[model samples]
Target: MDLLKSLLVSASGLKAQNGRMRIIAENVANANSTGRTPQDDPYRRKIATFRSHFDKELGAEKVELGKVARDESDFDTRYEPGHPAADANGYVKLPNVNTLIETVDMREAQRSYEANLNVIESTRTMLQRTIDILKS
Candidate 1:
């Protein structure tokens, strides 16, 4: 029963990490995305926050996505007067997404996801062994 509860908690973590990964992927995909018009703002970086909640059924704290927030930091300015999205002063606002930071976040999320998957695998193996022992 305890193992099952642990597995459930880990499953929640996996789900949360999966969501985080998706957001990271989206950020990477849109890193170079610019505004359609001069008045529009460029793409802002998205951040994922995780929170732990008590699960009565599992009797444990499980992780979940708290919020997907937009990074409010100012975008980088580039001198691209020829660009279509350039401002009147010949400056273009670049997206706030930093490829290096996103890549690191993605790697961390992938590792966390894999760790949760391993926990599920081990829990399932233990459960199967217990069932086998009881059958024998």
Candidate 2:
């Protein structure tokens, strides 16, 4: 039962990390996306939050993906008078998405996912070993 619960917890973490990875990917994809028109806003970076809930059936605390919120931080302004999205003041609003930040987030999420996978794999191996010992 404990092993099962452990596996469930790890699975939840994997799911959460996967969600985070997806958000990071989206940010990276829209890093260069600027507003088409002067009146339109540029792409905003998306952030993922995780929630922990107790699963009665699994008897463990499982992680769940929380609301995907947008970063409300100020958009970067670039002086591009020739750009279509440039305002009358010759300032263009660039996307809030930072490629370096997104890249770092992606790497962190990947590591977390890999860690959760390792936990699941280890749990399975331990369970197998226990069964083998019982048989012997």
Candidate 3:
């Protein structure tokens, strides 16, 4: 029963990591995106938050994905006179996304996802072994 609970917990972790990876991917994909007009704002980087709460049925504190929040940091500006979205000063506002940061976040999320998968696999293997021993 505890093994099953661990499996569930790990599954929750995997789900959270999956959501995080998606956000990171979106940030990476929109790293070069700019606003349509000087008055408009480009894509803002999104961050994934996690929280743990007691599950009544499982009787355990399980992790879950929290709300996705936008990064409020200032956008990078570049001077490009010919750009359509350039401002009066020939400056264009770029998305707050940084590819390097997104890449690092993606790697971290991948590792966490793999770790959770490993836990699930290991639990299943042990459960199978226990059943085999009982049958013998």
Candidate 4:
């Protein structure tokens, strides 16, 4: 029963991490996206959030992907007078997404996903061994 609960918990974590990675990928994909016009805003970075709650049936705390929030940080600016999205001052607004930070976040999410998978695998192995012993 405890093993089953562990599996459920780990599965929840895996799902959460997967969602986080997807959000990170989206941010990376739009890292260089710019506004079509000077008055428009560029792509905004999105942040993934997680929520944890106790599962009554599983008798364990499980994590889940929560609402994606937009980053409120200021956008970067570049001097590009000829650009279509350039402002009157010859400065173009850049997306808030930072590839370096996104890369780091992706790595962390991947590691977390792997860890949850490992826990699930380990639990399955232990359950299999238990069944084998019982059969013997």
Candidate 5:
């Protein structure tokens, strides 16, 4: 019974982590994206937040995505006089996204997702063993 509940909890974790990975991937995809106008801002990196809630049905504290918050850090500027988004001073505002950071976040999300998958797999194995024992 508790194992079934654990499966539910792990499923929630997998969902949350999958969402987090999606956000991270978006950030990475927009790393080189810039605005078309000089006065416009470039793409901003988004971070995924998680919160835990007690699920009455599963009787466990499950995690869920809270918000996709924007990164407030300053955008990196590059000297690109020919670029359309270049300012009067020939400086272009690049997206406030770092590939290294996104890569790290993606790896973390992948690990968390894998961990949840392992939990689900183990629980299913236990359930199958129980059924076999009963049949024997």
Candidate 6:
């Protein structure tokens, strides 16, 4: 593939990974958050999705960030009688966001982002070398 198309592919990947990281960070930040009222639901974990499509402009497959989906899993409950959001049974609804899972997802997104960055760097280097060869 041409250098420009390679750069475009890498750029798309970088954008997708960056979006995934943002979603993971938001989940981590709200892990301990509880609802304001017993009837109110706590923060739900968000999942990041990606879609691959053929780009006519680039004439290659490119990845993009898809819709942010909600985690339909049940929320965790903690016994906290004194808590304002506690129910009659002294159970407070906690976010389903698991810190460990979020950490792992963040790490994976970071690695993917780094890989795309490396590809862009390599492509740039090759483009520069080609220019130098032509000028010599």
Q: Which ten residues in a row have the lowest lDDT in candidate 1?
A: 53-62
lDDT of 1 at 136: 100
Q: Please estimate how well model 5 matches the true structure, expressed as its whole-model Cα lDDT.
A: 0.94
Screening candidate 5 with a backbone cut-off below 3 angstroms (N, C-alpha, C), the clashing residue pairs are none
List the candidates' TM-scores in order. Answer: 0.95, 0.95, 0.97, 0.97, 0.98, 0.98
Q: What is the alpha-carbon lDDT for the whole of candidate 2? A: 0.92
lDDT of 1 by residue, 29-126 (tens): 99998887788899999999999988886788899998899999999888989999999999888899999999999999999999999999999999
lDDT of 6 by residue, 30-67 (tens): 99999999999999999999999999988999999999
Given candidate 6, what's the lDDT at residue 99?
97
Locate the minimum summed-lDDT window of 10 residues in model 4.
53-62
Regions of model 1 farther than 4 Å from truth: none
Estimate, for each residue in 32-118, the C-alpha lDDT of model 3 and write its tens digit: 999888888889999999999999999887888899999999999999989889999999999998898888899999999999999
Candidate 6, residue 129: lDDT: 96
Model 6 Cα shift for residue 38 (angstroms): 0.8
Residue 7, candidate 4: alpha-carbon lDDT: 93
The sequence of per-residue lDDT tens digits that candidate 5 reaches over residues 1-136 is 5898989999999999999999998999999999999999999999899999998877789999997898999999999999999999999999999999999989989999999999999999999999999999
Q: Would you list the C-alpha lDDT of every candidate in the order shown?
A: 0.93, 0.92, 0.92, 0.96, 0.94, 0.97
lDDT of 4 by residue, 26-130 (tens): 999998899999998999999999999988877889999999999999999999999999999999999999899999999999999999999999999999999
Per-residue lDDT, model 6, residue 42, is: 96
Question: Which residue ranges in model 3 land beyond 4 Å of their true spot?
Answer: none
TM-score, cand. 1 vs. native: 0.95
